[model samples]
Target: MMTVIGGVDADRLLKDRHRAMWALGDYPALAAEVIAGLGPALVDAVGVHPGEHVLDVAAGSGNAAVPAALAGGRVVAADLTPALLEAGRRVAADRGVAVDWQEADAEALPFADGAFDVVMSCVGVMFAPHHATAAAELVRVARPGGRVGLLSWTPGGFIGQMFATMKPYAPPPPPGAQPPPLWGDEDHVRGLLGDAVTDVRVERRTLTVDAFATPEAFRDYFASHYGPTIAVRGAVSGEPERAAALDADLVDLARRADRGPVGGPTVLDWEYLLVTARVAGGSTA
Candidate 1:
């Protein structure tokens, strides 16, 4: 049932199910190998400085959180999954940085208004299911004139197409769930954050990925390690033909996107949207 939490409309059941889905796969591996650089990149973009209050929403395994902490900001890494939080703790510990890890729903972040100086997510908050709510929460928690930064996969990017490819085989999305890739669209995000923020700046960036040796290898890796892919595979597990078709489609997507030497390892340039804005009002101390 949908319930208002922290003044935001949130579906408890959907949040619970989402937590479970994210906890299923070996997400730490995926984060460490595929998108480890995003956190630092975002932190830098937001100009995180020593002793600023920073919040990393939907920070799976503390990707951005650890880096923020390392940069000397007082960082809080909040996510829906406890397992991921624990993993993030270990990561921070290993890096010799301290971060406050908490379980938090992106749509209903448990924080006071203007609680942070910099609110950021590295390809994280875009998947909150309710884009407008999540976007509002991001704004609400940032002090006036504070920064809000986000990195999300573009709709035309490899990851976006992969999600699209999985939709045909996966179960119906829960009510109020917006397509995550919409976060990458500049107009969509500006509309979501309308009139609440100022100095909105967007940059289109590309991340080079070459972790897989082949398209088939990329497909197999995602199937085994990515939560969304694993969930889709499970949805079609009862039908071998459907599962096989998905496998083929994933390979085709990767192959088509690959821009590597012929007969060489797979190389893909994943496009993403980087957005940074300031909450409209007086500066925070």
Candidate 2:
């Protein structure tokens, strides 16, 4: 049992408290969908044979970690956020299973080289500020024949289309609004991994995530769960007021979405992607 490295500071706790509150209101249903975002493809990819060591980066609330532990693998779930990790620990306890949960940054993993048989993230690495470094770290901690997998959102799906909607909220996006590198292009993905990746495969999957009944639904969720991070980032870049402005803009968008077809009880859409790749020299690769 490796010692877990996590401590909650006042700011982190406060930020996460807000994040939890936002999660309660924003996309609660969709959060479940994100839990099931990869479906069976990811579990199969992990090849979770009993006793194998696995590391799940950006494990969040233990979505992938749960399955890995249930499969009898000795697993560690690491994430940068403390609140999420605590939530994961509680979840593991509730399920009557044991998993090592750690608060660690993916870019600076604490494990030794080749420490894990498999390394993965459920659409997490794609969102890292230093993604290439993080990908290399995933490959670094994995053994020679180890497998690395990523469950990312595909471009042009319902989720992709939603990003297009987000653009309007930050029109002339707040200062320092840079385009995301992985909006939906294979080339962007290739650039992230470079050549250490011998084989890369992507499978499309459908996820009916109920984001919001209206655009306002979306805004409410984003404002709450994702709000603190966005606000800090925007504020740090001198766009301090962008958060409220964008929140307003997003609410307006949701109002427009209310007029969308199939608008009732909730907003639903099919959006998700299962991406599998290996860090060259794998027995299977």
Candidate 3:
């Protein structure tokens, strides 16, 4: 049974908020220009084959879905934000590929049990508030012996640190909401999928981001284009001093982590965790 507040399902309300938050950003641009390689990388790792039924959960703008379809698989890209789904549809259309784009919540996917040959999320699903529920959904929708792949930002990565930097100024998370970075922890994920999967493989990889020219560029871009950062900035927008402090801190973080030449482009190696495993035969619940 779902908890209800003011006649609305609490979880549904949260999902609605999440949908709006993601819709706030120019994520399609971010995915295409910066993190575009992630989807293909995860698809390659999962060995998505021709004619396979592939599902990309929390798939923002067809990151993995587009590539999976191009690999000759029938793909479905599911996300909470309709805007992102529309954007993904456009991308697929432009690529001359077909993908079934649907609005779906990662924690409660609208799919049958054992419905897909490949279930994956590239830097997606990790943002679902309830980690355990989302993990179970991932396993549940995969056919027995089907592959499950996930790519998430590590707790110690540049993106993780950015989240940490923003935490001080952000609003409190709802009850039962877990930190997104925990999905990057091997032990945490293993426990979440325990006994339901086998032949698990984990890899730590880095994505080199050089899109921003300087620390301020990184800060401003995030403020305008990243949903979470935009939300944080909005939260502090009314408080000018705190907002300025956040701006300064974000710039400082980028400056400290920048690996490029003393005065050239900003080079940041964002680390992430990649996990793939075969679903063990039997009922997934």
Candidate 4:
């Protein structure tokens, strides 16, 4: 007895789960708080200003974009998925804030040269066609005098452990799977930035995200929100049934998940990389 979600792949996986891909509620407010705390630390680090034209790339639901606009900057929120762009627009509107929402790919943008005074992306980009191209594109769109910023989850620390904790229940990742290092790791990110960044700094921060009222809640959250990860991954490569089976396996594993409280603060170890590099005309540094 097997069912499938049609043919899905990584892209399809995202497509299927875009709705569930949403960041948790209060995260938007929390994001603003994070920015506030890091804002002073990143003024020079990220070159943000009150009036700078900014683009929040992969700006799912405009959480960061709306706040940036409220801070008095003309902001545009862009993302690959039209669905996400639509969600972002609604969010901006709900907040009574005006923001330009656009559908664009990070690997290649349809904007003009030096289109933004400041370019920033949060929690997105690692899934792009190529991280190098995406990083370079950020530089390409920013004016030489402008700044490029990215906020990414720091890999292999508290956050890493969090993911690690869930790995057993996750669909088997590809072989030799090495996740890209995130912003918290300076040397790694610097290397990723190469010479494009004249200066770089990693501001480390963490927060307590509500884990779940019960393990079942966490399991259901992913089942509904994260999409059937296994099913989607298989469909991505055109093997729905395989993924479907894995999907069941995943849920089954979830039932066996550590039985704990229905509500508790699961401190998510996360890092927001606010590296502000003065755009160097011709490099990926």
Q: When superposed on Cα atoms, how far off is each prediction in RMSD? A: 2.8, 6.9, 2.0, 7.7
Residue-by-residue lDDT tens digits, candidate 3, 1-285: 778899988988888888889988798998998899999999999999999999999999998999999999999999999999999999999999999999888988999999999999998899999999999999999999899999999999999899999999999998899999999999999999999999899999999999999999999888888898998999999999999999999999999999999786999999999999999995433
Off by over 4 Å in 4: 1-47, 158-184, 227-267, 281-285
- Model 2 sits at a Cα RMSD from the real structure of 6.9
Give the alpha-carbon lDDT of every model: 0.92, 0.63, 0.93, 0.58
List residue ranges in candidate 1 displaced over 4 A. Answer: 1-10
Q: Tell me how far the alpha carbon of residue 146 in candidate 1 is from the true structure, in angstroms, after superposition.
A: 0.6
Judging by TM-score against the true structure, name the best candidate: 3
- Each candidate's number of clashing pairs is 0, 3, 0, 11
For each candidate in turn, the TM-score is 0.96, 0.72, 0.97, 0.67
Model 1, 75-178: lDDT tens per residue?
99999999999999999999999899999999989999999999999988999998989999999999999999999999988889999999999899876799
Cα-based lDDT at residue 224, candidate 3: 85
After the best TM-score superposition of candidate 1, give how far the Cα of residue 147 lies from its true spot, in angstroms. Answer: 0.6
Cα lDDT tens digits for candidate 4, 1-285: 122346544544533344344332333443343333443333344655687898877776665677678777788888766666676677678879889988777767778878888888766554453466677888778877677777665665443443444454455644332353444566766777787767565566653344555434544455444422323443434656654554555445444443434444322333545565777664442
The deviation in Å at residue 225 for candidate 2 is 2.4
Clashes of 1: 0
lDDT of 1: 0.92
Candidate 2 lDDT tens digits, 123-176: 555555545667789889988777777776665654455455455443253222
